[model samples]
Structures are given as C-alpha cells and as structure tokens.
Target chain A: MSRAALLVLADGRFPAGGHAHSGGAEAAVKAGRVSGAGSLEEFCRGRLHTAGLVAASLAAGAVLGLDPVELDGAADARTPSPALRTAARRLGRQLMRAARATWPSAELDALAREFPKGAHQPVVLGLAARAAGLGAEDAAYCAVYESVSGPASATVRLLSLDPFDATGVLARLAPDLDRVAHQAVEAARCALVNGVDALPAASAPLLEISAEVHAAWPVRLFAS
Target chain B: MHLDHNHTHDGPPAVSADAHRPDGRRRALRIGLGGPVGSGKTATVAALCKALRDELSLAVVTNDIYTREDAEFLLREAVLPPERITAVETGACPHTAIRDDISANLEAVEDLEDEIGPLDLILVESGGDNLTATFSKGLVDAQIFVIDVAGGDDIPRKGGPGVTTADLLVVNKTDLAPHVGSDLGRMAADAKAQRAELPVVFQSLRAEGGVKDVAEWVRGQLAAWVA
Candidate 1:
C-alpha cells in the first residue's frame, strides 16, 4: 500500500465538502458547550469515543472489502437524527465525487451509480482508501481523526478560539484517536466474519439532537 | 490515470468542469461573481439574471457567508424562478467554498443541471468577502470582481487577485461616486494599469442602463462558449 495516499485522503484541503459542515460544533458552540479550549477538549473527547468510533468502524469495514451498500444501510440504522442522516448522505455524495476523481475505480463508480445522491461518508471514505491501496487500519485512522479534527478546526472558526489551543486539543486527543482507530479495526474484522452488525453502533444523542436543531436554524454558518 | 480502470461504467463523471455531459450535450457556461462585502455581488447576479432570463436558460448558485440572505434576496426580487436558484452555506469562509473546497458549490450547480437541465448559463455568486477572494477555474469559466466606488476608489489600485486576474472588474454604484468622494477617472486608470487589457465596467444599477454592459459581456462569453 502506498502510505502517502493516506496523507492525501486525510488532508483538510481535499475538497470533499467537509469545510461547509461543522459536525455539530456550531450547535455546541451556540449552546455554550464548547466555549474555550478546555470545554472544546471535553466535547471532542465525547465525540471521539462515540461518533468517532462508529464512523471509524464503518470506514474500516469498507476498506476490508465489505459490501459498501450494506455498510451504508448499517450507517443509516446507526444514525438516529434525520438531519444528520441527510448531512451524511450529502457529504458522502460529495466525497464520492472527489474520490472518484482522485482514485478512480470500478468499485467506486458502481457505488456512485447505486447511490447517486450518496451512501454515508464513512463508506465512501473506506472505498476511497481502498482505491488508494490503503488498509483497514489506515481508513479507520482517517475516519477517527476526521471526527475530532473537523470539530476542532470548526470551533476555532465558530468561537474564535485560539488556533494554537485547538491544535493542542487535537494533540492531546492523539492517544484517544489511536485507541478508537484500533478498536474500530477490530470491530471491522468482527464484521468481516459476522456481518456489518458487528460494527460499533456508538451514538451521540446530543449530537443528533443538536444537529437537528442546527439544521432548522434559518440563519447559521455551517450547513449542519 | 484515474479514469483508466473505470472506462466501462456509464455513470455520472466525477469531475464537474467538463464542457459536455455524459449524454454528449454541451453544459452551461458558469460565470462567477465575487467581491467585498456590500459591494453589490448579489445585485449584479440578480440584474444579470433579469437581463438574460429571456434569451438564455440560466440558473444561479449563491454562497452565503452565514444566512441564505443572497438567495433570499434573489427570490424576493423574483429575478428567476424559485427552482432556478440554489444557495450554499459557506461555514463563515466564503472564499474557501468558492476557491479551496468547491465541492458544495459543484454539487449545487450539478444538481441545478440535473433538475432543470440544458441551461445556457449558471452564475455562481460568492458571498461578500475580501479582495483576495476569486473563483477557482475549476468552478467558473469566467469571473467578475465587483467593487463599488462607495467601498473606495483605491480598491483597483490595491490590486489583489480579484482586481488583477478576474475576467471582468466592475466598478459599481457609479452614481454614488461623487457622494462618496471617489474619483472614477483615477479608478479606471488604476484598473487599466492593474489589469492591462482585461475588461472593466463602471455601472450604476440605479442608472438608466442597469447591468447592460455586464449582460453584454456575458452574452459575448456565451457566444464564444457555444461557438
């Protein structure tokens, strides 16, 4: 596997539409849940263990050659909020377009045709990783890292939190990110044996609720 | 190299800048309008739509910094049918949405085509931002940077990417030039110095010939595109 491809996929500037969504951070910031770096760290930690773990597992499974369509459905079943589901699919579709252009494959094209709208972002992420010749662990790491990094950078923009402090938040979460990626790969292996239900169904009810609220905002910065 | 292995499938192409769709029909000419906050980007888009809607099948995609205000404005004005306009939330970084990560805008434009197809033009309007902001070539075929005399006549003299590289630079609200203490002659001279041979239009939407020169430039671009 080309290890360099992982960097390409993980880049914040990959142009897959992640810049427009805050991963519920907008709602969290408005609710005063993530005011400064300390609270931002707490919010990211909670997110890392729950939503991060689930997304990582989904991405890892996709890298393991699991059926992406079924994986997409599994993603839908795990996400409770209707608004979040819509965001996931939209982001997934955007990611699919970027991935196909970056690392075109018959598998990706087939998946794109199947879900023209989208198929959950983690599923597309894993397929993109696979197409780039990356492994399940790499895909998991990318997914896990993204779950926190998105919120951290967005919080910097949302609250004008010090960029250094936000980077420190991400740095402090490195061990947690490693653990989540490891756990995700393990769950993905279990799914490879026993189907996608073996993957983690970790949910953040607050994130779901806040996402719904954020979606309804007549005036807001991020899309979700 | 990316397209090598995927030759057989008949699916939507991954890249969005292609001149032709999968069915072999020419796609719409996408023009971007970008400028500083309150420089009249939205007004230009609305005026362009109103001027060209009769002759062209046109649509618009708006990148609003915080709210759907620009899209709401176009809708409120009834310049185009509601279905022909779409808004993209920029997450407080309008420049990023148009230049760095244009996926959302691309999706918006493609969705417009998929839904209301065979369009002749699509105007992608960026949220009011700094002078550094310009549309990516991947996003728009041509770009217009709008700066009004009210903002400052020295903007062209400032010579950022928007002023120097845009296909067309528009000095808007010319009627307010005297009121705002801006020198239109010096502004034009500085713009010519900065842009060399590129086109610049001094327009006043409140004036008798509103958006005429811009509409004509767009028509010329469309003619070249369809040629």
Candidate 2:
C-alpha cells in the first residue's frame, strides 16, 4: 500500500463534510469540560479510548474485508445517541460522494446503492481507503487520528485557545493514538476470525448525552 | 492501479454538478446569492420568491453562520411554504460551506429536488460573510454577489472575488445611499470598471418593483439553463 494514500485520506481538508462537525467537542466546551490545552488533551484522550477505539475497530474491520452493512449495524449499536447516528449517516453520505469522485471503486458504488441515505462514516472511510490502495492499519490510523484531531481543532475555534497549543496537544497524544490504532487492528483481526461481534464496543456516555443536547441548540457553531 | 477503471455506475450521479437526475430529467437551475452581513440578502430572497413563486416552482437553501434566522424569516414572511426552505449550518465558515467544501449544500439542494422537485429554480443564499466569500461553481450554476451602499461606496473598487467574479453584482439599498452619503454614480462606474461585461443591479427592496430587475435576470438565467 502507498504510504501517501493515508495522508490524503487523513487530511482534514479532504472535503468529506467533516468540517461542519466538532465530534462532540462543542458540547464539551459549552459544558465547561474543556477549557485550555490541558483540559482539551484530557477530553481528546478520553474520546480516543472510547468512541475512537470503536470507530477505529469498525474501520479496520471494513478494510479487512468484513461486510460493511454489518459493520454499519455494529457502529449504530455502539453509538448510543440518536443525534450522533444522524450525524454519522450524514457524514457517511457526504463521504460517499467525495470517495466516488476521488477513488471511484465499484465497492464504494455498491455501498452507495445499499445505503442511499448513508452507511456509518468510518465504514465509508475504510472502503475509501481500500479503494485508494491502503491497508487495514491505515484505515485504523485514520479513524483514531480523526477522533482526536477533530476535537483539538474545534477547541481552537470554541475557546479561542492558541492554535499552537492545540497542535501541541495532538503532538503530545501521538503515543496514545499509535496504541489505540494497534489495538483496533488487533481487534479487527480477531473479528475476521470470529465475527463482527469481536470488535470493541467502548462507549463514552457523556459524549453521547452531550451530543443529544447539542443537536437541539437553536444557535450553535458546530453541527455535532 | 484501480483508479484507471471507468466510473460508469447504475445509481444516481455522485457529483452534484450533473444537470440531470437519476430518472434522466433536468434538475433545477441553482443560483447562489452571497454578500456581507446586513446586505439585504434575505430580503432580496424573500422579494424574489414573492415575485417568482406564482410563475415558477422554486425552493431555497440558506447557509446561516449560526442561527436559522434567515430560514425563519422566510418562513415568517410566508414567502413560500415552510417545506420549500432549508437551512444548512455553516460551522462559522460560510465560505467553506459554499466554496471549498460544498457537500452539505449539495445534499440540501439534492434533498430539495428529491422532496419538492422538478423545480424551475433553487436559490442558495450564503451566510453573510466578508468580501472574499463566493459560491462554488459545482454548487450553483450562476452566482449573485450582493453589496449595499451602506457598506461602502468603494467596495466595487476594492474588488474581491465576490465583487469582481460573480455572475451578477447587486448594489442593494439604493434608497439608503442618500442618507448614508454614498455615491451611486461612482459605485456604478467602479462596478463597470471591475466587471467589464458582467451585469449589475441597483435596487431598494422597499421601493415598488424593487426586485423586478434582479428577478428578470434570474428568469433569463433559467431560460438559458433550460435551453
């Protein structure tokens, strides 16, 4: 697999409609759970371990040739908030459009036909990676990185925190990202041997609860 | 290696720029309106809807920076049925939603077509932003950049992308020019200099038939699109 494919897939500016979402960071910021770099790091770390792990495992499973339809069901089962589910499907649909234009895989086209509304976003991301000649590990890395990167950048906007400090927070969390990606890949391998049930189902209850509240806000910066 | 394969598919087109829908009928003519804050964009949209609704089937998609204020205003005014208007959250960057990353706007327009479709026109109004904001060509066939005399008479001279590159440059709030001490003649001349052959419309929606000229421009665009 080309190493550069991972960079293209992971770039925040890939134009897959991820910019409109804060990945639950907007809620954390508003709830006073995240303030500066220190608190932001804590929030990202928690997200990386729970929602990040689950999303990464799902993505890795998809790249491992696991059925995306079932993986999408697994994703829905892991994500407790109805609002987050809607956001995931919306992001999935948008990502499908971008992926079909960029990579143009028959598999991606089939998935698009299957889920006209959307599949889960991580599932689409993994299929996009496969279409781009990337591996399961690359897909997992993409998911885990996005999990932390989203909230870090969002905090820069939400708190007016120094951009450099946000970068520092991400840089400091590199080891954790690597560990989570490794764990996710191992889980995906296990799932291939057993079934989709072997994937992690880590849950972040506050993130789920806050996402529900954020979706109803009449006025807010981020979508979720 | 797989990238060399043909993209022929059996489902709806992935790209939003396709003029035809899944069933092979031409889609609506999409027009985007972008301008600075308080530049009468929503008012112009309301007026245009009021002017054209009886004759054409139209829907609106608003990219509001934070609130659904623009959509609510259109609904409150009863410009069209509540179902005819949709608002897209811009995450504080209106330009990104319309220009750099248009996935959200594309989905909104496609949804409009799927639900209230075979429509003649779809008006996409950008959130009030700076002079640099403009709609992506993929998102809209034609774009109108709005500026008010109250903003500055010299905006045309300043000449950003929106002022210089839009299909139509509208100088709104012409009635306020006198009170605001803005020179319409100079604004017009500067606009002529910046836009060579592109069209410009100056109007105050408070006046009788204020949106008529702009509405006619839209009608011409629709005629060309359908042709």
Candidate 3:
C-alpha cells in the first residue's frame, strides 16, 4: 500500500504539473543567490525547513485523519506568496483527481467537496495520503521528497549539470528527509491537538521576493 | 457596540448555512501548451481558439514571465471574447508558477470558469522554456508540447521528457521545413521512436489555419470526458 501510494505520488506522469517548476531554484540561480552545488544544497535545505516543513506537517495531519479543511487553511496562512499559494491549490486539485482515482475513499471525496475558496497542495496531499491508508510518516516523506526533487531535477535541466551530480545532491539530502519527516509528524500531532493557530509562524521573505521578481522576468526557464 | 433593535438574528450567526459550494460542476478540460521560447506556443493557442472556440466554451491563461505578450497577441487576433483570455505574470521562473506552486494559474482557471459558467475548455500557455519544460499535471488535464521545425528537426531526436511524454507533441511551422532544411518526416519518426505509441501531430499553423489536427485531438479528449 505504501509502495503504491509512493508510486502514485512520485510518478512524474501523475498530472499535478510539478515538472514546470524549480521550486525557487531558478530565480536563485539567476540572481546568483544559488551558484554551485553548495548553494543549491542550502536553498533546498531552507525550503525543506519552511515550505517543505509546512507541507510535511499538513501531510502528516491528513495521514492522521485530521480535518483537511483546517489543514488547508493553515497552509494558506503559512504560504505568504499569492503565486505560491495559487500553485499549491492548483496542484491540490490535480492531486485530488489522481488520489481519488487511485484510492476511492470517502474522506478524500468529502475533502474534495469541501475544499475551501483557496486550498493548496500539501493539505490535499495529506488527505490523499490518509485516504490511501498511509501513515503520517509516509505522507511527510512524500511531501518533503516532492518539494526537493522538483528543484533537484530542474537544476539538471537548467544548468546542464551532470545527472550523476544531481543525484549525488539528492542522495546527500536523503538523511535530512528522514529527519524532516519525523519533525513534521511531531508538528502535525501538535497542530491536531491544539489547532494550527497554536503553531509558530515562520516566513521566508527573500524567497517570496525572488518569486515575484522571477514572475516579472521577460524570459525564464521555470514557471515559479 | 449596541445591537440594532431591528436585527432579529444576533450578530452574524456562526457559519452561513447557505455558503455557496466551492466545487461546482466539473470544469471544462484544461489543456496546457509548454515548450521552448519562440516555439510558437501562442500561435498554437490562437489556432486552437479559432478551431475549437465555436464547438467548446473556451478560455485561455497565458503565462508571461514579465509581460502579458501572449494574452495581448490573442486579444489582438480576437481569438475569443476579451473576457475569456487572461494573463499570469509568473514574476521569475515560468516553470515554478506552472510546476512548483501553480496557485495563480489555478485561480485564473477557476475565475474563468466561474465568470463564463460551464465552459467546455481552458487552454493554459506556458512561457517559453527549455527542452525539459512540462506542465504540472495539476495545471492541465492534458498537455501539448510545441516545437517548431525551425528549432530543428534534431529537437525530437534529443528526447527530453516533454518531447517523449507530453500527451501530444506538435511540430509547428512545417511550412518552414524546406526553408530551414528540416526533415519533417524524420522528425516525426524520431518523435514516434522516442514516444512509442503516444501520438504526434506535425502542423503548419500558417498553412492549416491553426493546428486542426491537434484541435481535433482536443475535441476527442473533451468527447471522451463527456462520455
């Protein structure tokens, strides 16, 4: 079941449209904010902490059978960028289609019906994960992995970097994925017990600015 | 603050029981066109609107990294009602908006659907990108990857995921094949070799009056959806 869930979530063909984006790596690369492998790692690490963490936590909540509506609202409040929020919700809708097709659960169907005015990806993914009968750890792992893989894959295409080198970067980040997943499960438990409003708020201003600037570029390689 | 005596219901009673449902009926099929810069993504979109607009309730969302150039082009051509076409300024990496985040595009699509009411199709045109660029599955129900003959017949041979895996691959500007010394047949063969059974349409938007073959395929997808 976990394997099937992973395959559905990780498959590039699933139709959530992750291929067009580079997380924020494209703008970071263009601005010289990320130049070499070291900077790439740092950028990924930062994302893993903020957006990645939030997504993982939401996914965990979904795995734990918490309310997706509340999780989606929390995700919206956490993601400050309108562009990012928009992207997440689009992905959420797509993910919903795929998840419902694969799992066919009442929880997923209900969440899809109740998806508020602006639902994003992580919340939907979490609910999908639960519907698939996966646990919080599994959902967290998928959320973090998807967030990082997008940029890692984009860097290879954008820079013409050796595929082996890109894989190496991903391999190095693997241990952190485990750590982040654990952290996410814990966070999710806290949020479920006390509500997402009780969780600490963290924002990444530079990344937000980069997304805005990247949006304004006359030409670009990635979407966001 | 004292409550008004005329108010029968006490201050905004909890949740509005009649809050309109967010998810309405199934939306029109959304198709995204993405590929390298100058690969004729806009021309393909315009041709699609011309070909399919009358048959389908259609709208377009064009992503321009900075400018609303593609939307402007569609408007200039009057492909659809001005209200049906929208532009998203992706601000940085066009891919991120289409791939990584996708919120703005989602809202644009939803807004279009809400305003138009029961539209049959929405086309999202991605900003120009490299060989690997592709639509997030979330963004479109199906996607078309456009590569012009001038970009080289070799592009198909290069074999990126977009070339090998997009639901449809459109080799545009086939009319320019002779001028550019490109082998349209060989390009088609190469694409088929890479994609196995997936379909490929070689189009000259200039000659064919806007991708009739691809437009037809889109019609088929919509037909299947209804079925």
Candidate 4:
C-alpha cells in the first residue's frame, strides 16, 4: 500500500464536497460554544471522540473489506439527525464521483449502481482508500482527521479566527487524533469478527441537536 | 484517463464531464454566469428567465455566498416555479464550488433535472466574488461572464479568466455607463481586443428588450447544443 495514497485521500483539498460542510462547527459557533481557538479545541476534542470516532471506525471497517451496504446501514443507524443523514449521503455521492474518476474499480462501480443517490460518506471514503491501495489505518486516519479539519477550517471563515490559531488547535489535537485513529482500527478489527455491533457508538447530543437547528436557519454560511 | 466516453451503463465507470445522463438521454445545456459583487448575475438570470420562459423549459441553480438570497430572489420574481430553482451553499468559497470542486453544483443541477425536468437549459449563477471567479467546463457547457459599468470600465481592460476566456462577455448595466462616466466604446474595444471573434453583449435590464441580445445569444447557444 502506498503511503502517498493516504496523503491524497486525506488532503484538505480532495474536492469531495467537504468544502461546503462544516461538520457542525457552524452550529456550534452560532450557539456561542466555539467562538475562540480555546473553545475550538474543546469542540474538536468532543467531536473527535464521538462523531469522529464512529466515522473512523466505519471507514476502517470498510477498508477491511467489510460489506459496504451493511456499513451504509450501520452509518444510517448511527446518524440520528435527518439533516446529517442527508449531508452524509450527499457527501457520499460527491466522494463517489471523485473516487470513481480517480480510481476506477468494480467495487466503486457496483456501489455507484446500488446507491446512485448516495450511501453514507464515510463508507465511500473508506472504499476510496481501499481502491487507492491504502490500508485500514490510513482509512481511519482520513476519517478522523476529516472529522476535525472540516470544523477547524470552517471556524476560520465563521468567526474570523486567525488561521495560525486554527492550525495551532489542530497541532494540539495531533496526539489525540493518532490515538483515536488507532482505536478506530482496533474497533474495525473487532467488528470484522463480531459483526457491526463491535463498532463504536459514540454520539454527541449537542452536535446532532445543533445540526437540526442549523438546517432550519434561513441564513447560514455552511450547509451543516 | 479514458477520453473515450462510454454512455452505455454496461461499460467501465465514468464520472465528471460526462455529457449523458443515467437514463441514456442527453443532459440539458448548462450555462454558468459568474461575475464580481453586485455585477447583476442574479438580475441577469431573472431577466433571462422572464425572456425565455415562454419558448423554452428552463431551470436555475444559484450559488449563494452566505445565504439563499439568489435562489429566493428568483422565486420572489416568479421567474420560474419554486421547484426549478436550486441553491448551492458555497461555504464562502464561491469560486471553489463552481470552478474547483463542482460536485455540489452538479448535484443541484442533476436533482433539478430529475425533479421537474426535461428542461431545455439550466443557468448556474455563481455567487459574486472577484474577477478571477469562473466556471469549470465540467460544470457548464458555456459560460457568460458579466460585468457592470459601475464596477469600473477598466474591468474589460484588466481582463481575467472571466473576462478573457468566457464564451460570452456581457458588459451589463450599459444604461448606467454614461451616469458612471464609463466609456462604452473603450469597454467594447477592449473586450474585442481581449477576445477576437468571441461574442460580447452590452446589456441594461432597465431598458426594454435589453436582455434581448443576451436572450438571442442564449438561443443561439441552445440551438448549437442541439445541433
């Protein structure tokens, strides 16, 4: 497996429709919880442990050659907010297009045929990693990093937070990101044996609740 | 790297820049309108909608910088039914959405066609940004770059991708040119010099039949697309 494949998949500019989404940072920012870099760190930390963990585990499972349709169902069941579900599917469709174009494979084609509208994004991301010849840990790292990167970048746009500050926040979270990625790969290994039930079910009530509120906003920068 | 487009569903997978839809029919001609802030891209879209609604089936996809303002404006004007207008949130990177990562805009246009849709044309309106903003060929068959006299007459002289390479360069608000002390002749001349033989239309929506030139140009584009 090529290490460069991980870099390509995890790059912030992968053009996978992640730019339009803020991963709940918009909602949290508007709710006055993620105003400053300090608070931004806290927000990323909470999201990293919950939503990020779940997404990473899913990606890892998919990379391990688990059934994508089952993983998609697991993704849907894990997602509580209708808005987030829609976003996940939309992102999935977008990632699917980019992935299919970049790395043409039978698995991607079959997935595209099955879920033309979309499956869950993390599933597609993991499969994209698999097609790119990346390992399960690579897929987990991509998912977990994306979980935080989306919000950190969005915060710079939303609160006019300094880019340096945002970068620093990410820097502080690096060790934790590594740990979460490892844990996610471990969970994927467990799920490979015990079924999808072995995957993590960490959930952030605030992120889910805020996503619903953000979706109803008549005016907002990020989609959600 | 497969330049050979396979429209057949049984063939190898293809995505991005495909001209055919999933149903084996051709997709509607997509024209992108991009310009700077307050350059009348939205207003031009509304006028185009009003002008061509009788003869053609049209839909609109608007990229709003921070809100659904452009899409709502089209709906408020009753230019098209609510179902035909889709707004894509740009996450403050309007240029990125249209030119770099066109997935969302493509999705919006595809969904519009799927919902209300054997349409003749789809106008993709980019959020007002800088002169550098332009649409990717993957997103639109043709593109119209709009600029107003108020922004500066030198916009033509200082041409960007939007001004120099657009299929059509529209010097909008020509009616305001005199009021703003702009040289219409110079703007036209600069545009001609920048793009030899490429079309440029000067329009002012306030004038009766002002969008006629643009409408006619759009008609020509649609005709050529079908041909």
Q: TM-score of each candidate?
A: 0.97, 0.97, 0.67, 0.96
Q: What's the number of clashes in each of the models?
A: 0, 0, 35, 0
lDDT of 3 by residue, B114-153 (tens): 6777787889999898888888776677889999999988
* DockQ of candidate 4, scored on C-alphas against the true complex (2 decimals): 0.63
Question: By how many angstroms RMSD does model 4 differ from the true structure?
Answer: 2.5
Q: For model 1, which pairs clash?
A: none
Model 3 per-residue lDDT at A171: 88
Q: What is the C-alpha local distance difference test score of each model?
A: 0.92, 0.93, 0.77, 0.91
Model 1: CAPRI class: medium
Interface RMSD of 1: 1.4
lDDT of candidate 2 over B1-227, digit per residue (tens): 12322443357455668777765677899999999999999999999999999999999999989999999999999999998999998887899999988999999998898888578999999999999998988999999999999998999999999999999999999999999999999999999999999999999999989999999999999999987
Count clashing pairs, candidate 2: 0
Model 3 vs. true fold: TM: 0.67
In candidate 3, position B65 carries an lDDT of: 67
Give, for candidate 1 chain A, the lowest lDDT window spanning 10 residues: A109-118
Tens-place lDDT digits, model 3, residues A82-199: 8788667766765665566667777766666666342578877877777777778888998888878888877877777777877788789999988988998898888777987754
Error of 3 at A151 (Å): 2.0
**Candidate topping lDDT:** 2
